[model samples]
Target: MNTAKQRKASLPERGFAWAAAFLLALFLVASLFSLLAVQVMTSAGLHTGTATNDSVLDGQMKIIHNYIGVLADAYGFEAETVRQSVSRDELRDFNLNAAAWWTGVLAEGESRTIPRWYSPAMEQAIRNAVDSAGTGEDPNVILAEITEKIDRTVYPLRESLLTTGLDFVNKRADIPGIVRSLRQVPPLCLVLCILAAGLIALLAAREVFSSLKYYGTALAGAGLVLAAAGIIYAVMQLKAMLSQASANLADEFGTMMHTLFLEAGGAAAVLLLAGFACLFIYRNRFEKHMAPGEEQAA
Candidate 1:
């Protein structure tokens, strides 16, 4: 026991132990960030929240009204006349369905038909317009013309809104696969990190207490980096950065990013605390077991 106590780690062993600790820190940080991303992307609650957000709903309404205004312009009618025909409940349902469809497509790795409520609303608007005008024109003929115009205009808009511009080269189908792979990353990284930590303990120290120093250093380094990055990202003026985007989009994106970063920062704080605790234990408890020379070397 005395002979073992006097033994010191060789320079090569110390180098390898340090390398392992560094890799452990790297893997730990990667695992944390990847886990956060997976949680955000896979969360149904997040998607629902974004879909029902007032800003997002208002933006959708504005876009729909603009399309209605175009139809009114073409047919020589008041835009408000057409807008009045579509109820708020109908618009809400459409937005909800659109959100659901987007979630389904990404999860299932396939394209589904886009949700549509505009054409029916437009038809009702035209019928009201014809009645008010006393134009004596057959409503069916007007409906057919208007329907054709919608197919050319509104249908394309719906498609563009739903499809995320990754329609070519089968990239859209790859989304689900990518998400699956990401889901595996955190667990894999964690396992590798644990292995690296064990390697550091084995290669650098004869006593378990001595290994705590390396563990504390690696954990503290990783925690500091993650906490700083997360806090900085959360505090950035994301909405201002997205000024050119539609108001609703900017607000929703900025809010989402803020929430995500804050959560990350909170998680990193736990890690930072754990790291400090380990260091404290090593200094107060472990140092008593070592000779002055050994303690200084450690």
Candidate 2:
């Protein structure tokens, strides 16, 4: 059995060294985890956006094509009027009118009378090809022909209805652009970086204080300084991370912002608990200030 003096001599002075080393390891793990998680989230968002955009653009093209077909059928114009061989100027005008109709939906509201000239131009062009028919008789025949064509073209109308089912794609587009456009660092990474940096700083402060230790008072003072510096570093980094998160929240995945906040808040709570544990170890192990007489009585 060893005497008190012998036992004391056997113990090394590196008392919180292992604990500090463990925290450093944890900090590194956390940093890597944050980096990987952000990469996964960002990649998923971009991939989803790409697939959704392709589907939406294809669906929109089909709807526009079907709508033009319906317009041609109703007017009973020559097939060439709507065919791809039409003059660029005429096609541009047609597209402008269609775009005007769509844009007007947001302003003048739906059910605006389509300009009379647009229908008559196509009707006159088709009617002029035939001769010797009564004026109203040709238009009546054209109207009946249009109705029959519509009844037969059920597939186009069905395909056009796909747009209504695809409203979700447009909503998804708004967010991915924001995510891609803003190439800032993720808040989680910044927070982890600050955490790792603070942990390293704490380890350094502990080493510095141990080297300067003239007495237990100096060692205790150094531990308190390390803990305080760690807390300050954590707070500053946390604030920067929060600011970045807030900017990202204004994004379309603003819904995801709530989720991110919950995750970050939970991480913060865990760190806070760990900080308190560090302080408890520091106070109990290093800062006991019992008087010499009290120590003798014990």
RMSD of each: 6.1, 18.8
Candidate 1 error regions (>4 Å): 1-8, 54-93, 118-165, 171-179, 231-238, 286-298
Candidate 1, run of 10 with poorest lDDT: 149-158
Winning model by lDDT:
1
Q: Please, what is the whole-model Cα lDDT of each candidate in the order they appear?
A: 0.68, 0.39
Task: List where candidate 2 sits over 4 angstroms from the true fold.
Answer: 1-36, 39-251, 285-298
Question: What is the TM-score of each predicted model, taking all chains together?
Answer: 0.67, 0.25
List clash counts for every candidate, in order. 0, 0
lDDT of 1 by residue, 82-175 (tens): 6666566665665567667656665554567776555576677778886876656666676675444433322323455545453552463676
Candidate achieving the largest TM-score: 1
Q: Across residues 1-298, which tens digit of lDDT does each residue of candidate 2 receive? A: 2111211211233444334444443443454345434543444433233223333224433443465466555554444443333233433344344334333332222223332113345345445532322233365465445433322221122222433433355455643444444324345545654564454445445343332222222223334444454466456655455446432212313323334444444554455555555545544443344555544664
> What would you estimate as the lDDT of candidate 2?
0.39
